[model samples]
Target: MPAPTDYLLTHGGHRVEVTYKNVKNLRLRVLLGGRVVVSVPLGVPEHELRRFLDENHAWILRAQQRMRMAAPPQEQLVDGGRVQLWGAWRELVVADGDRASAREVDGRIIVTGADEEARARGIDALYRRELMARIPALREVWEERVGRRAAGLRLRRMTSRWGSCNTRTAMITLNTALAKRDPAALEYVLVHELVHLHERGHGPRFVAWMDALIPDWRARRLAMRGTP
Candidate 1:
């Protein structure tokens, strides 16, 4: 296999990292931290790459802006720190103990462990457990409304998408991060993916079904995107 070539391209005072790879198409990605990356076929000339970047300058700028706006504020995950859960802010309480455990008490999340890392892991475990407990009930409700049943459900940490559906297998994989969001937002994602079971694309019929099934879906989506 050939190695990818990396270079930098500057246009109109903006710069983007360009990589030439063994691929058939040109792809542009604006990452979460406002970094711009363009991947092109190995044989593409520098002039062509520059032209492509030039043409898509506005799009790159808008994508970077949106990413910057949507990025969540970083958390230190220490005692007295706060985290968002179910669309609401909750205080984190850390206690000293040999065995790690996490639970919610009086609107605060209490984590006990030997150190910070243990406490963090304890909290993550709590998040996964809570998601597992909530998904079954939510799935049951949406299945009744959509008149379709999912064959399986899975959870994982995802950077870009909230959920995806495998229409072929009738499975839905949800982002574990949803546990930190509003329960209603999670429902919206569940419905959106389940709708994909009936209609694969976001066509008119799909939109119609969503409208009929979850009328306030657009609002929930906007909330997910952190839009006002």
Candidate 2:
């Protein structure tokens, strides 16, 4: 492990602390906040790091601007953090015991617990149910538009890609995180995955097909990656 380096960065009215991690291939990355951070190999010269930053200067600035512009919710969805569901904001209630179930009661989604762990699980379960219900409707819409049949659909909590398709099996796997974003993004992801049924790799033909179907596919793609 490398010792941490802290740097100050400003984004609109907020100040963020950035920490750099030294790993292989050594690259610069920024989290959601407008933080300037860089990582390099153990023996890389300072001059090389400067060159890398120069080459990526435009990207860094754009990322910072977008992060600053995207308004963050006043409250988080963590334990005791009031969360908005559907159209109303409600207190995140936690209950103890195994029987604690998450369901909408009087326009509020309730969980049972005292800390982050219990509240997170219940909140996740609630989102998972919503995703499950949406999948079938999404599949129907895309199937009609694409005129192709998929082998199946499965939902899983994935850390990497939003969704993936097995062309051979015709089955699609969607990320659980999609449940938190807008419904249109979910539709876009579904279409992207299902299009894999025809084109295994993303080539000119794939782009053409996607462009024909969703004119703003590129914008939608960028939005999914949390880019502006």
Best by TM-score: 1
**lDDT by residue for model 1 (1-228), tens:** 564488677775667888888889999998866789989998888788888888988998778656744666545466656666787767677877757788889888888888877876777778788889888898888899998899999887778899999999999998877878889988999999999999999999999999999999999898889421
For candidate 2, the per-residue lDDT at 87 reads 30
Q: What RMSD does model 2 have?
A: 16.8
Deviating ranges (above 4 Å) for candidate 1: 1-74, 98-100, 113-117, 226-228
TM-score versus the correct structure, for each prediction: 0.63, 0.59
lDDT of each: 0.82, 0.69
Indicate the worst ten consecutive residues by lDDT in candidate 2.
9-18
lDDT of 2 by residue, 163-208 (tens): 9999888989888767667777788889998888879899998898
